[model samples]
Target chain A: AQSVAQPEDQVNVAEGNPLTVKCTYSVSGNPYLFWYVQYPNRGLQFLLKYITGDNLVKGSYGFEAEFNKSQTSFHLKKPSALVSDSALYFCAVRAQPYTGGFKTIFGAGTRLFVKA
Target chain B: DVKVTQSSRYLVKRTGEKVFLECVQDMDHENMFWYRQDPGLGLRLIYFSYDVKMKEKGDIPEGYSVSREKKERFSLILESASTNQTSMYLCASSLRLALLSYNEQFFGPGTRLTVL
Candidate 1:
């Protein structure tokens, strides 16, 4: 079964410091990984996706993620954290099995708290 | 830019009432999804539609149903609303590809439904 795990329930980072949100996946075949952000009382917005391309994927709001094939990890990163960047982050995965069915899975989520 | 819109931002209903949540997307996406968001649980997929009149059960399909009679619109139905069903419902749409699809979903603002 394809599944995603966001080990951290919450992360606190200081402003101007680099931030990293961890994500790991388990899938039989190649994985299609994605990062999404959701603010308080708002819907989720797509951040970036890794589908068989360069490992480094840049997304909106100057965020980027690195897809580590061996480690089966796609971690979301930002050069510098901002107070406004504090939000809930989610990692998702989609894969096709040998039998030919598409399965998508989402992590429990990581709440990022950027401290000023 | 792709835009997904939900019919209501907030709703309150009594227990056992039949509830309907409507969603519309303007981008002409071939795929639409319904999810419920809760604290710590992240987003749980309830149902998805690959095309008009074609629906697939997601991870959490019990206690809810979906309708996609039109391409642009998708509706979620709760036969009898209960307190456990109170949640933030999200609607998302993405383009369906011929091959193994790996597309980022665009989400609506979301509807916060409260069941009493």
Candidate 2:
């Protein structure tokens, strides 16, 4: 019943310009959101997450995401894009059932291309 | 740091052959997961184990089975390798049920399996 969606199949950004990868979620109760990045021929690495507290979460590689409660969106952002930042980005959500424990759901992913 | 490692980086197998993919984690995580990754599908969970010898079916578990005999190792098995099963397989681990826990999962480099 819980799911996450990445709106873009691909995003092209010029170096030194801001970049964003949009994600939205549908879940029961409050949502636990996450961002992950995968380089070419590599596994995914955790970037950031938002469970409680601040809506603006800062993560590795100078990236950050804003969790919008009203819009049910968590978007990954960078002040300036870099060629190295070009990778596959996946948005995920954690589901905590009343019975305890948790499960994770991942989005289809967004391919980010940063042109230098 | 938590390190998750897969047994292989690349593998080639014939259709109908039994394929085994092994994974191990340095961290004594409570949860271990096997995921299948395709170009547009993102990460589809095949199976996950919350504890040693305890496994649960995930989103896509039709042709896959998993084993978690030890706390640090998890193995995924394809009963009959099909062309559709040819994809990247990723292993991951996470800390849960502990005093200090986050739903973040650490992933291995991944194994690219090609079933001909």
Candidate 3:
């Protein structure tokens, strides 16, 4: 079974400081990972995905994630955090439709709070 | 730009009431998904449709059913609305073609359902 784990329930960071939201996955063979962000009263927005590409993938809103094959981790990062950047972050693993079906398993989520 | 729209932003229902949550996508996507979002649990897939009338059960499909009569629209049905089922419902769509580079799912604004 493909699954994702986000260890942090909440993360606090100051504005202009680097921020990291941790994610790890367990899957057979290669894994397809994704990052999503949700704001207050809004649906989730896709940040980035790692299908089969460069380990370092850049996403929207000055966000990026590094896919570590050895560590089985895909962590979302930002060079500088902003107050507006505070939101709920989710990590997901895409399941190949052949084995089971086209299902994506998401992590429990990490609430990021950026202080101004 | 792909756009996914949900029927409502907020809803209030009573116990044992039948509830319908509708989702529509402007893009001609082959795969449509329904997920419920809770505070800590990021998103749990309730059901997914690969094509018209072809629905698949997701991680948490209990107490809920889905309909995909047309390619562009997918409807989630709650047979008997329960307090536990009260959560934010999100609709998303994506192209099924694995060969396509852009397989990211586009999401709707989400509908917050309160069952009392």
lDDT (CA) for every model shown?
Answer: 0.91, 0.92, 0.91
**Per-residue lDDT of candidate 2, residues A1-115 (tens digit):** 7889998999999999999999999999878899999999989999999988999999999999999999999999999999999999999998764223457889999999999
Model 3 misplaced regions, further than 4 Å: A98-100, B99-102
Off by over 4 Å in 2: A98-101, B98-101
Most accurate candidate by lDDT: 2
- TM-scores for all candidates: the values are 0.96, 0.96, 0.96
CAPRI docking class of candidate 1: medium
Query: How many clashing pairs per prediction, in order?
Result: 0, 0, 0
**In model 3, what are the clashing residue pairs, if there are any?**
none
Please tell me what DockQ candidate 2 reaches. 0.58
As a whole number from 0 to 100, the lDDT of residue B18 in candidate 2 is 99
Candidate 2 lDDT score at position B42: 86
- Specify the poorest-scoring 10-residue window by lDDT in model 1 chain B: B95-104
